[model samples]
Target chain A: MTVVDIPPPLPVRDRTALHERAPGALSPMLTRLAEERATGVLVREHGTLHLAEGRVVHAESPLAPGLDVLLTARGTLDAAAWPWTDDIPAATHRLLVAGLLPRGALELCRLGALYDAGYFALAPSSTPGRFRYGTTAAAGPPGAVRPLRAVPVTALERETLRRRELLHRIWPDPSADGAPLIRADPVAPPPVTPRQRAVLDRVDGVRTAPQIARELGRPAFHTLVDVRRLAAAGLLVPRNTVPPPPPLPPVTDPDIALLKRLRDALEAL
Target chain B: MPGIDECLLEAMRLPGARGAALVDWTSGLALGTVGEAPGGDHETTAAEAAELARLAAEHGAFSTADDTEVTPPVEDLIVSNRDSYHLLRFVVTSFDATVFLHLWLAREDGNLALARIRLGEMAERLVLG
Candidate 1:
């Protein structure tokens, strides 16, 4: 992903001006820009909100999580779900016009994901209550447009959204990508719960199940069983590209204190 | 034939059953709690239970090698201790949120197979808001 700084307090333009001038409209409007074809970032404005798209794909928006990152996080949607189809901008426009999802919701998904993926803060939507388009410019990746045409489109999208929300529940740290892999200080005492203890027995981190068993002096099958139990308890973090975690809320209530205590006790073992 | 409350009540009815609760996983909020927790802190236990669900959901999302993509949305999570077992079963759906039943039972008294079957039956009748 490319990053371009927006000049301080970008002069806001009207929706029609954006629709006619933004890259979102440029392809259709391309026949008209008789000079040099622009190949940078286009930030479209609708009221105060902006939706950004590169020539090949959308980078960020106030509404949607980055589809690629969201899909990666869900793990349910393989990379295949986000195959590169020509004309991503048009496809996005079509998805919006088709009313499959509200434009803002889509933007939230992308924006939320981008935020989790380590991007800039999303500005609140400033688009007028009336539907219209606008434009802005940012640094962008070089590539032709690519649209998403993955299978179980609805399923993929929903799963990714669910995963995104789940990640937000933990910390903002992107390290835990839903893997069964977890890291615990070996020197720490085992947790009180047998389930947690079982998890610790399997944490070699570098090896798969069979290898973990050899190191721990356990049967491969038994090790797998224990590993599955720990995984179910959410004690393991898988290795690989992790999805953005759900946003964790500040622990405010007194009950949260006690709960954290129990959690710590359990995981410590 | 059981309602949401009925489900929890039924889970507690099992031999050696200790306590039960209904949790909404989306927000990790326990909708209701029944029976006494070891510390007699239902509120805290419920909150913790939600955290467990959150963790499980996160692990599921990032573990790409697992068959989660093929496995139907998780219907249940069961954790066993030396003396007891804790079961958290998700009520399956495609809506914006999810609900689950959390049950605690004495290991010596609990029948895992039976409990699973009953939980599955209970999940189908749950009325999610």
Candidate 2:
């Protein structure tokens, strides 16, 4: 096997104060790592961001699915044939060779995943997490992977702030961000935009905004914006009326048809 | 299959181009940016432009009668001020019509018709993975 030179891990910082100083201290930690040109993974409570030469190459969060899931969720890649492995680079190469995804498209999806996951990873509520700078090659979860290009940390921060503001502009309620979507009464349903209608159809009153986004294979932020807009328009069930359900099980065979329908509805919208 | 950076760079090469960005209208995120922003801040400009894009894409009056299925019923929107022109060209992807290429152009040096044509071409070739 060919050996690769891995950079030394940066010393661990307590960062408790940073977390207290701001809701999302991960930005500062990321900024520091970028400034130092550190190359490693910054693990946090929500997810992990892989940094290479001071730039963020990839990010993964439980709140947002990874690129693989996004691709497969959209039926771009066959779920059964997905190559699951710890070796990301090799897997990426294999996918390229197999024509599963074009190089440019893969990169775009990677970037999209980075920002999508970054929104939740750097959320103010994802606090009290530790930061360890070490190569993720040996540390990331079994399926966690890195991207081909490393995006500047500043760009990611700016995009995150923009998304937050966009959602706020649509509706001021943060509760709508995580609440399960339920269609309002048909008798007096507020007029909804096409996209909002598409989202409303998937509102089983059980799946939260994030879960709906995963099912639709769209970015979580996009789903949040739609949900917030729908709530603002009074087209969705009031947040207080619906109690959040227990965590959902992974999408299984029975759900594929539902996901396909969601996908078709989204495309039609 | 040009990346956002390359697409923005190509957009900037247009006549009188002041700034360009690939914005996700749904989330108001700038996938990439190039040149100078109208207000000297790309982030704010992107968000503001997204508001316009959202309005055009969502309002029924702006859509054609025959376009019952397209997410963004309108093809493009142009907002011109005293000195600059803001062009929002919608790009359809595998998913919803949530992304657009925003171009801020100087009125004196910009050619609106040509810019629109070029933006359309770029949008056709532009690929977001």
lDDT of 1 by residue, A1-269 (tens): 88998769966757787666543332222222212333333333411122333121233332233444343343423445444454334444444445444332333233323322211111222431221233422212223322221111122223234334444444444343223465543344333233235436556555565455334322232344445544444555456545679899988899989999999999999
> Lowest lDDT 10-mer window, candidate 1 chain A?
A116-125
Per-residue lDDT value at A133 in model 1 = 36
Please report the candidate that would top DockQ against the real structure: 2
Taking all chains together, the TM-score of candidate 1 against the true structure is: 0.32
Q: Write the per-residue lDDT of candidate 2 for residues A1-269, one digit (tens) a residue.
A: 98998989998876786668654434776778878988787877777777777877677788886766777775766777668875544555567556566554555566677799988887875366556676644223234233355678877877777677767777887887777667776567667777777688899878888888887887787778778877877777545664568897766776897988899999999
Listed per candidate, the RMSD to the true structure in angstroms reads 21.2, 15.3
Give the whole-model CA lDDT for all candidates, comma-separated: 0.47, 0.75
Q: How displaced is residue A163 in candidate 2, in Å?
A: 2.8
Model 2 ranges off by over 4 Å: A1-28, A75-104, A125-127, A136-148, A238-269, B68-70
A60 Cα displacement, candidate 1 (Å): 31
